[model samples]
Target: MASSMVAVGLALAAAGFAGRYAMQALKQVEPQMKQALKSFPKTAFGGGFYRGGFEPKMTKREASLVLGLSPTANKVKIREAHRKLMILNHPDRGKTHPDRGGSPYIAAKINEAKDLMDGQK
Candidate 1:
């Protein structure tokens, strides 16, 4: 009987130590995860951008491609393209209609296309 009691006590002690160690490890890792998330790029066009490398510079042709527009599309065409893409790509719209799989990257691309169009004006 005494041996069984001792064994139970040791098991409890081991479990307590393991739980404390796990809590400590979790506390150490949480901040690292948050920092990593915070350091993620603000704009990632279709998961194309990465860190510590050459940033891809989009030309008017590339921007048009992202917006699903023809290269010869005019300002009004670009605006319509941006509006249509934004309706499908905005994060909020995706959240509200989770079935459609809207992409924040597409929304950013739309914004980029609009900026390019404005710059040409």
Candidate 2:
């Protein structure tokens, strides 16, 4: 019937108007959102205030802990610890290895700790 067609046409016009209104509202909000973000503290996002030294420097003590060595461990002990840990957590050793889970990140940290220990000698 003509009445049904009119109803469909009205519904379509209402949907189009709603869509246009929503787009305008979003446009109005966009600038305000950007301004709010700019006014916010950089540290809140872990980028602005903490850029340079936010991360603690890897210390000899921390390196020894990573390698499971005593603070007074010598070069030989450091090397031994490094090798043992690498054998267990080297990225090449897939995580499916029995009783061990190797990760690329862990392997990198292990290498870094070994290098730090070596540098002290």
lDDT of 1 at 21: 100
lDDT of 2 at 34: 94
Over the stretch 1-121, how does candidate 1's per-residue lDDT look in tens digits? Answer: 9999999999999999999999999999999999998888654454564445212876776676667667777778888878887887787885655887676776676797778765652
TM-score of 2: 0.47
lDDT of each: 0.74, 0.78
Assess candidate 2 and give its lDDT.
0.78
| CA error at residue 81 for candidate 2, angstroms | 0.4
Off by over 4 Å in 1: 1-55
Q: Write the per-residue lDDT of candidate 2 for residues 1-121, one digit (tens) a residue.
A: 9999999999999999999999999999999999998897543224333223212667777777677777788889999989998998887786566456688887888788888888943
The TM-scores of all predictions, comma-separated, are 0.46, 0.47
